[model samples]
Target chain A: MKINNLFVWLKQKPRIAFFMCLPLILMVACLIIYPFFYSIFLATLNKAETKFVGLANFLFLFKRETFWLVVQQSIFFALVAVFFKALIGFIAAHSINELPSKGQRKWRGMLLIPWVIPPALSTLGWWWLFEPTYSALNWLLEKLSVDAIPWLSETFWARFSIILVNIWVGAPFFLIMYLAALKSIPEDLYEAASIDGANYWQKLFFITLPMMKNIISITILFSIIVTFANFDIVRVLTRGGPIDTTHLFATYAFRVGIESGDIPLGAAVSLFMFPVLAVLSFIILRNVRKRTNEV
Target chain B: MADVEIKDLHKIFDRTEAVRGIDLSIKDKEFVILVGPSGCGKSTVLRMIAGLEEVTEGDIYIGDKLVNDIPPKDRDIAMVFQSYALYPHMTVFENMSFGLRLRKFSKEDIKKRVEEAAKVLGISELLKRRPRQLSGGQRQRVAMGRAIVRNPKVFLFDEPLSNLDAKMRGQMRIEIKRVHQHLKTTTIYVTHDQVEAMTLADRVVVMKDGKIEQIGTPDEIYNFPRTGFVAGFIGSPAMNFIPGNIVKNKNGYSVFINKQISFYLDKEKEKKLEGLDGKDVLLGIRPEHINEKKSEDAIEYDVKIDLVEPLGMETMVYFTINKVQLCGRVSPENNLMSNNKATLNFNKNKFHIIDPKTDKVI
Candidate 1:
């Protein structure tokens, strides 16, 4: 009888529960769902100066000469940068994990300095190094009896510079994540594997990698999404320069919207990033769910 | 299949000597259990023998081959961990087959071996299921199955039944004994539970403070413990120790409890204490040896019953005599109750006497 009465009392407290959730519901409605639908509405319609032109902005984007070139370059940059970042990050994390606790902390702090430094400040220093004349790289090359090389002015050089900057800035995030994942594994598992006749390499392949599979998949998907939309480092270093060879979706949208003042076209270009982000997020969420199930 | 010998095995962990100069030998096909309380270094010794732990200043031999530098794999031993440590991602079949697969065994060989081990453990129907999907007892069988399939020369179990509930622990105990009987592998098990050690061990090596206190059969350890630590650690409800001096009374030598109760020494113990008259001694008695009702050859004592625990067939009566609280076993049919004044009797012939200073049997 008391249990039933308590249940009835809980049911009658809807007003209290509703008031408790009011702030949270309002925050979500105002911040997330509101802006989401608003962006879709804005993407569908043209700006003030131009009337509503359904799919015309998207068609114009496809017809543009620079769009295909920028798309190709962006794909190459994101893929190469993400691939190297994962490899180098995994290697660094493994090496750091092998060190003694104090040594690991020291090396980790030292390696993370690049990530802690402001990207704009670091890219400004990089800009000076890539200057056409009086550059430190050119000075080094001259000392080696080599001719001065064009680094940032040329299309390929700009692309390479942006990819290098992306790797430098992004690898540390993955290294930190992988290091945490490595430490989270129970030490007993390795001890057990060693007792079961596994050598160092066998332990690595069978235990370490399999244990880190979930972390690696989620981290890779996350890196791909972030690198695909990355703009700050590339914009500061290359400014989408050398015929827009370093332009990713983020910088391309910035150029079309702010630099070129083509609001409709810019919105369409930025909207192009939506499908990619959505697909990547879906993959990441699926991978996370799978990882939890594995645990 | 292997006789393991340890000579002066010492392990120092951060200035704490975990295993201090231990020397012992385990015969072939012998189920030797290293039993002790926590931090007694029994597990450390087992790991050292398995080659999983580095030996600081000793040599270990398995079947006449020096394994001081050999890896656990080269030592040809299989270990069942306390956690079971079954690969969560692998099915029971795969987990059992892993060791075989690592040795480059053929597909048919791995299948046959895994199937045979599963059959032995009665886990054949659950072979295809992952470890996380199985209950604790089933997982324990899978762990044992994993070890059995290896056909290793030596088998090591580190508190393998410590995680199970009491009933499950008893069940697994019987299962392990049955498996050991059939396989007859050279097994070394480490456990803090004396009951497991007593039931499972062919010879129990009682350890304390990183040293072997005594090594003997279960009966020897229970009937005669070399040290006070072993005496207190080896029995359920633990043997009670009453500190007093052995005085030459008119009747014979009696251990007087200072105006509370007096126990006359038996002939064998009295003979051993012939030269040590008037010396301080400790009277050790198991709970079962003390009864609430008097018998023909028992020394009577008036005890205040503080608590009564009815354990189905038998009841344990907790009481105090001479400010020392001790447990006495009584029949459940006696209807023992709490806070009741009672007269209990000690079986003086079965009592053990130890020198207080040396802690050795007098």
Candidate 2:
């Protein structure tokens, strides 16, 4: 006679693995999946939460000029910041790598200081640096006879200031990643290229770049995600000032959902980034998988 | 003019001297090998010649032009590294043609040179394969092919076969020798393997402690080593060294061992040891010099075989003399056994008497 016992079945090896994973699964369910679903529900609800207004909140967000502005600003901010971060990171990694190994260690430690500090804390320091009257950078520029220009109050300069701060915080991560990639290249390959009549630039093109193709793609992908959702730098530096020109998805959502108390509309606005992000992530991840498999 | 000339070359890293004042001139088509133990600066010397390393204090001339200030790119030399150093991303063809393409060789000329080198290396069919797709031996051949396509003024190899298995190493050794013969280009090879030095080089340079111990043809290095180090380092199973003395005897003088056996020094050997009588010296006995009583006039010793290794062609016999393990070679037909007494014949004329204080052979 067979007893269909659930407890006995749960004692099996596969079931034990599942049981070991139960805490993380339960945490994800309660903390992440539940909120996600609740946000979706909130996006479809009427203002009083008594009636369903499916797609109306979304339609409302789609029609707003400020919402579209946030979309453009978010993409532009992420792309420009990631690009400069990658460029600075590669150049820094190369110059540091060229130093003797002892110097390389010291410089690497110094460059990584910004990354080691918490983003919010570092953003606060940057806010002080970008302060309109007491700005150290403007003081230096004025000392050099340059005219004083608005950093946070202007439309263009505010976006530029936020991107610059984002780059300062994020470039070190790229520096570490690219340095690791550069070190992974065999020293002998460079020597061989030297004997084969390749100068520095030739070696960089034929040997270094090809070897680092995968790391560059992967780092850019990772930085894009982090920068696209970035809030600390923008909030500290500009707070979407100068006519809300620099409002990104995260800061705009905070303004609407938490600050202005339009919870359902804010949820709908926040969810607007999801589909684009999903498609971009899917494309890039597939490309990364294909490239890594090649290696 | 000589193809390569190094004058009182020296290289020091930090405080440690890697290559101390050394002078060597290589003929236009000669194949010279620098053989030494690791950290002895043989590879450092080769790298200096290739301009990969800066000479701490000396001049290196290539083709009558002082090349000390030239970068490696203009050194007109191609090097094969121990790791093969092929571009992993490039196909075999692209890897071989890279230098040509960089140098602005015509398309047809690059193709011809690459195909010819590939044919010479027996890798014609592997042109499209990437380095990761090739086996260790094929990768080695491709590396050599990459060098061969250039037909540079000099070829430098830094332990190119060190990464290969023993079988592949032997095969590549023969292939390298054949290529050297075919190309007749000036070549310099560096290795820690004495067998490679003995078998490959037109002349071998033995180094120790960052200085050249001796430079000679293979036969001279094997038969007439100038120092005790060279004598001991050049042979397999190593040259057995026994401490002894030359004492005056009724019939001229004899090398006296530990009451086991002594033979009168020949006139030639006696002349070589003129002032060393009654002085302590190291007697260099190669394993091949000691056999199973080959001649009646040879000094005979009843040595208790401590260990017997029966190689297919020879039997290696080991015994302790003054706490120094001495190795001797006998025919495998002798069928020697361990823990048994066997009389070994020491070739009296072949004794290399060394003044232990100077470490120099008489």
Candidate 3:
């Protein structure tokens, strides 16, 4: 394992380091670097690829109302969904960590089922649950003498259904991360806090939260990236429909490039996510590094 | 008057009994130590006194009040854990002042108390540093400082020095004793090291297999151990146990080991082995009790040396008596080496005679 450390090898042998880096360099050039530049090149061409229409696709997308809606909803959808996922995941991890080991295992397994199932398959089941006539939730509300609510047919409910499904598929990842972090904390800390006259809430705020801060930041950062470009839930459940209220960047790109047959426009729309992702990663990673250094 | 008393204490984890029927009454200002091997329930007893673990049966009293249901926070006790358990994110000042801050002490009061404890611990300059920045010894001092800052009625230390190196452990042992003398708070320290027990405790409670084997002053424990287990457990290099028989000789009754090794019973020793003539008994000989130089009122035996260990000031010479290995501490000036034929002198009065059947010192 020590032999696999790159920094050690780089410092010890220059020739071997260059030789080792060749495969990765070739991979980036052929698979990643080439594709990224080619996508940018494709974004510059017109729909039929017959004419160079520099800035036209960008100008057009900037002018469209649906493009603006997708932009607003993607940011909203990523932030709100990631926030709820993190909150629910933290609560579940904290609660399950308090249980006996056997019970904790049972609950952890059951909660992870949502994450383990394929997203498209699960989203299909969710779409059926949101059917206008046969939605099981609305049937329960109707039996309770409450008005049946529109799930997929209305814009608000459609966006709500998509965010709910996204959270369901992403929260288990956070639960596993936070739970491992919780277990890694020494039990002596809690015992010391007890002897130091700390109540439960005091221990939580003073000890647990501070110790888990780095893991919390890292998990949220990863969830933000994954949730921002989420596709399966919006595609399968709402089909980016209900007047495009639930159109995340991924689904919007799919509609413009693959479905609507405007490859250049779709490339530009998908390219829009890179800047936002890069900025969010920069901020969260900086905080994480600062916290780690302080520690 | 914050003495600690435990009556009929027991701690059972599932089917394994950790502490069984332990009764200890530590006087106010007394520094009592619980010493034992691993799995001896010494730490369990300490935790029950600190209220970190639930009392499976019976009662614990502090300051004359039964505290069976009291939480550790309300028990008015402070513990220095073995791992130190200093909060990594907080400065040493905050770590030491956490208890007082929890009780709503003013900032100035908290700062004064923390500074005082830090000065006592010689860690005043490390106040701004976090735990990760401190060395093992400094972290240990910070843990002690945290306990001292609380100024609780009782102080509990659970193997606090076991994590340090040998040199650091020795230094911290004296530091702990000095701290105990200064604070004069009723303190209960737990350690598996017999050296720590002997050096630190006003009285040591030796435990084994979830039960107390003996409780006495260090001198009493070392010299007049009532049980064979106590005799074997207290000393370094351990007490060598050799089984021999008492036989009536032409002069009087003597302990004989293959005719080459025998100790003539004096008047006092005769009285000790009265009515047990010709019966089997175990000789408990400490290494220091067996010396190479001759002395008054000691027995001499010639042995073929098996091993020699030079320890600067003294040499531990290993030999055998009738195929049973025995060790003797001698001055290293002789340069005794293995396979040498030497005469070892055994202090007749110093050796203990334990009855083979009862395993009790006679």
Candidate 4:
């Protein structure tokens, strides 16, 4: 009787359940399942022809020397850029939070300016400053009696320029996240710490850092996924130039499929970014869920 | 525990003067309670003593050392906040030992002190639990336990029992009093609840508008409030104030209320009313001062009982005198019924008179 009554009540709320699930069901068919199987089908066969070339795309992916070099470059760029971004962002957030309430709003607004501007527009400015001729940075170095170094034409410098631009574009994200986490902490905890004879350094280590562990982990995870899969800043600033020293997975996919017209190889290279992003996403989501349970 | 002395302490917050220049000396092992209405700066005074607030002027001495420039941690004072402020992430043991750990005490020493405090507070079983896992009364006990573990020079409490329910508040009130009695720390507690102040404080400092209104023992405050505000504020259901004129009647001197109810005064009280016989004076009388079953033995007045508050042991009868509502406690066995007229007598010797202009006791 109880089960029948529950089913009757459920029938009464059919519209609510339907409205809630409409978008998700449609997205599963249109965006997720359809593209997933279709991408696998495209990756297995060679260009427009449905010839079963079993493992050729995977074997050819490893045989290409440029693919391995791009893999190393992407790892180097993402890890270095993420490290600097998270460190600088945490420091900037601490400074902003320490400001008086009235001044804090102005400083936060200024810090968000870089994050608010379009990444492509900002990268265009960086591209202009590192232009081979009439370069502003090289011109300034020459005036200071230093050699006019080729910023974009050199392998290491080109990679370094792209990583720097990524940091500039991404640090504000971490800054905002850390600031939110800092504000969520109650002021009473610090008061209690001070009353416990904890100096500033002791309080930061024992209270602030431990309390911010969840947020710090989630922010770094997000930075990893975004930096690894990033395309705009690298494509605009360096175009994976200087003998492919700065080529990341996203740009490599673009180069092989759009620039070089090797669709199957491009699909294989693009699919390589999935595992790194999936692992990072899983770790971040798990940490976030654990924190929610703790709270 | 040590004595605390504040001399001409003044604190100004922007345009408002929070704690005006005031001097007070609390003796060793004294439990002084600062009691006042909200925004009357009682908490500010307690915070100033805790070194949580900067003194804008004057000096504060904790056991003869001028601690005006000392930070809260170095002042050797522990505070139990109204919200308890227990570290939510730390267990009760950790919360109690945090200060000791920061001062770099030995691990065993911290454990011993925490255990001793938990035993004193009767919370030994709750040491491993975080604050969120504890009940409200338990959290209050943890907060007190944290303070007791420190054994500071003085203890500061900011309305620590306000968050508990009424019955729990009463129980915690007694527990706090017992803790104070055992520890004998020179504690400064702040609360807006006058009942708590009356029951818990060895001496109550009644404040208003950032200034001390009166400082005296609970009996002295209840029996001899120096001002009208103190008299009105210190008592539950408060003392009744009736506007009347002291007149020279045919028999002797008396206070006339309405055209009836002339309360005759004795010679000593009449002499005290010498020059003010015809002046406008307000009479203050406590609820318990009036008796319902009147006789010729005391001065009597006929009143129509408007309402009755039966409190099991006694009953409070509400009546009116000269358009002012007055309440008086009578024995529960009096068979008092609302809307019935009865003769009630005032204990003339205990009557208080205030100057209408200054509201000061005369």
Candidate 5:
């Protein structure tokens, strides 16, 4: 009788569609929402977990030089890597777009190999390539009548190595996305631009770039968020080494929270990323919304 | 504006020959329309003339300059696409001025040209609005404004009015003619609509299956079509074809449609069909050429009316004679009834004799 009543209720009210989505809502709450507030609660606790410290952990991180260094490095790492990734990806996508259709499939498959491989496994291979004594790049340098240079031993080189590897792995995502955006544009726009007496660079600036602005902005925002919280490459390649100069928020939080057993301090360091990300996302999303409405 | 000459032009995509050896010449400041069915390669010919498509086996001459190897940007052509193809991000002013700015025009010159074109198109108030904010007709004007600001040597339109409603299409057709009169640019318009072809084209080039079927003025194409395809394609309610055999008569020749119907040809038509006697031919008669009232010299045939459609201006009468369905235009005052016998007069002087083997008018 209750089953019959429930079926009748489902038939009468379309609002029951909300009930059908309840399981997914509950799962998200348990997995994502619960951990989010729990991390904030953990960030406010003392070391011993007996009483709330009331921003003490955040105050402590603000006073540390290493913390400030990590902050600066994190911003620099995300900005530089994302910029190069977007640039190389855009150029590669245009090159692929210009190739004959038969040749494009082969090039696209080869370029996407780095993105398809597991990040942890690929970073390990990069780590081996940057090894101090047996690096392949250094060996090549030696054969070219140049001295063997340290790849991971020095501060600047280690930072460069990690940023280079980040670009290598992340660039394929941008390539695929930009390629899809390029394909979505109608063919007639280019033909129209050509008939308008536009050169190649003019077509790129006036037609191609303006058409791709929305996708570019959203892709950059997403890549920024992912790159800022990145931990696997730094963890596998340098492990926040070379005097901890390459430590990002994720690695620094791991170093403080898990390695040093200061969970509250680690939570506090990771929580700092949220506000920055929130502001960036809010600005980008608002711009995207405005652009969408304009169109 | 300059004249365009296409010599033995062809375009091949893989194995499919899209355009097969088309040769055409346009006089300076002439408005030519390429009209055909969907796969007839009219658009392909336009694109080749614009240098957007590579000519596989011929040369294109714009103002006596061989332009087969020239890129589209150097061809000094402007095309208004069917979709308008406006830069969605730019205001109407920017869209119109994009080409001039690309050529490194000074700011004052760019503004002058864009404003002049916009004012001519009567879109001055819409310069600040984006394309998506405008109506379809407004967007179409902006596209034309973009093309006009460059003042290119040649103007190409690829079914630009196919996207608009019937009312707007009629309105824009006059505007396009007016623009051509004012600018006097060598314009080439392509469309599949015969009405648009008739109303707008100074001369029409009819195409069929990668080849030019006929090219003539609109009046000649409507009245004296060179091929049966053009005769059938250019008219509303379409010209009807009735299979018949030309038989030699004592005095002249008569077309024997069936045992129940036959008509004698006049002196001029008989001379034209002198040697073609006893050959199978198809009679082409437009719907308007078959009338309801019988005249003194009109040949009358009895037919069973199948349907009667009242279209306010005239009524269309549908009937079948010898298993061939045909439409005839009649005055609504007749009050024709369906499923009844009615005699329709055939305007013998307006008939066409088509040789069925070659689908050509003889």
Candidate 6:
């Protein structure tokens, strides 16, 4: 009888709604919540999983020079790549917006090709172009009477190449996002601005950019997170070569934990990204919420 | 302020002709209204004049300069949009000062102009607030203040009061009229509301299907519509049109509405419609022109009231004449009942005779 009553209660509106979402809740628990806590647990364990060393792995990582280098490289890579991506994407979006409607559709579809291609496969294509000896870029340089670049050999060139490839892949995301944001602005605003005696540059500064501020901030924040945690591009292109100078947090964590067979140390290195990302997300989300409330 | 002249202006969007060769010369400091139904190219014509749209094949002159190739920023016009397109991120002061600042005005001048415009629009208290913080009516006032601060050669209003509620629309209409009187800038306003056109315009240009149906004063458009389309478009509850044939009798001419009802033409109407005898035509009379009081110069007919709408000041009586629905406006004191027979009289002087083929006044 109690079981029957429980079933009846479950059939109520709110309970039924909760039950309908039960699958998604459990899926999230297994996929996201479980792995997050499990990583923390693994970070506390010592090598071989026989002993618990509280904060030792973190302290050891902090003492290492390579860990500091990885942190600096990760922050620099994310900031520079995301900045270039956003700039180029905004310019491209404006260009596309200027085209006639039929032409805009054609250009939008063509510009999204870099994004639609799988990152790893396209990164291999970029690797071939950046190959030290038989590089296509070198051939073009020879044709132009310019010196051949040591694209993936030297440390600086390797970092530049990785950032360039990241921008090539990521700029389309910003372009698409900014295009949607641009389209959402009412056309009458531009008309009013023009009739009020605003030139092209004035309209861009006063109308387009101000209206797109919220979306731009949110897109940059999301791209920062994605670019900071990026692994596939670096792994496929540089593999943290040239004395580990281009090693980001993800690549360095993989080298330390999976490749070097020190799971606790690797987990600790990966876990270091949490505080930085959490702070960034908190600040950006607060800004977004404030803007939304104003609107 | 400067006069604007548009000569044979045409806009062809792909295959569809949005504006089919319109020519208009607006006097300096005059308020001209372009009013029509939606998709009638009234807004298109306004945009073309503002330089927001490229003129396909025409010459536009503002003052003495030809502006067909000039960009909108160089056109020296200020426009208030229907959406009140205030910059969402900027404060009201910033929104109003944006145009002046772009024109390289001094800081003190920008501040003075914005403050003055805001005071004129009665939105001085909202100067520091962002557009999102203001109500709809406040935002509309900010939009007007933005235009007022520019002090351009002409002011264009594209249905500026449409987004407001009814009461606010009525109030804003008066405010707009007052602004026009105070500034005396040559203005071109566009709207689909006939009442707005009648109330605000020194000259009302009524358009239909991308062509000007009639351009006249409000009184002329109301009393002497040149076309059937203009007659039907300009009046409230619309002027009732009944298809009929003019019959020439021994004494004079009368219109046979059907077997039951016939209306004799007055001397002036008969002189105007003499050539169209024995031809099918449309007889139009405004709802307000029909009355319950008996008169010597009115045609009396007994009509069965189908519906009665009491609107406090006046009541509308709806009935069918020759199977065509017709409405007559009567004073509320008449207290007419529905589904009952009543004697009605249509003012003979106010009746319109329209040629059926051309849809033009006979």
TM-score of candidate 5 relative to the true fold = 0.95
Worst 10 residues of 4 chain B by lDDT: B292-301
Put down candidate 3 lDDT per residue, A131-246, tens digits, no spaces: 89799989899899999889998999888888898889999999999999999999999999999999999999999999998889888888889899899888888889888888
lDDT of 3 at B85: 95
Which model, 3 or 4, shows the larger DockQ? 3
Task: Give per-residue CA lDDT, model 2, range B190-288, as digits (tens).
Answer: 999999999999999999988999999989999999999999899999998998999986789888877876777777666777788799989998998
Those runs of model 4 whose alpha carbons end farther than 4 Å from true positions after fitting are A1-15, A24-29, A47-49, A139-149, B248-254, B264-277, B293-297
Which CAPRI category fits model 2?
high
Provide the overall lDDT of each model, using Cα atoms, as 2-decimal numbers: 0.86, 0.91, 0.91, 0.88, 0.91, 0.91
Off by over 4 Å in 6: A1-3, A12-54, A143-145, A291-295, B249-252, B258-275
What DockQ does model 2 achieve? 0.87
Lowest lDDT 10-residue stretch of candidate 5 chain A: A9-18
TM-score of each: 0.91, 0.95, 0.93, 0.93, 0.95, 0.94
Q: What is the TM-score of chain A alone in each candidate?
A: 0.86, 0.92, 0.88, 0.90, 0.94, 0.94
Q: DockQ scores for all the models shown? A: 0.56, 0.87, 0.81, 0.62, 0.80, 0.80
Isolated chain B TM-score per model = 0.94, 0.97, 0.95, 0.95, 0.97, 0.97
Which candidate comes out best when scored by DockQ?
A: 2
- Candidates 5 and 6 compared by TM-score, better number: 5
Better of 1 and 3 by TM-score: 3
- The single-chain TM-score for chain B of candidate 2 is 0.97
Per-residue CA lDDT of model 4 for B262-360, tens digit only, reads: 677777766667788688888899998888655564568888999988999999999887779999999999888999998888877677888788878
DockQ-sorted candidate list, best first:
2, 3, 5, 6, 4, 1
Candidate 1 per-residue C-alpha lDDT over A94-175 given as tens digits, one digit per residue, 9 for 90 to 100: 9999998979988899888778898878888888888887789899999999988788888877788878887988899889
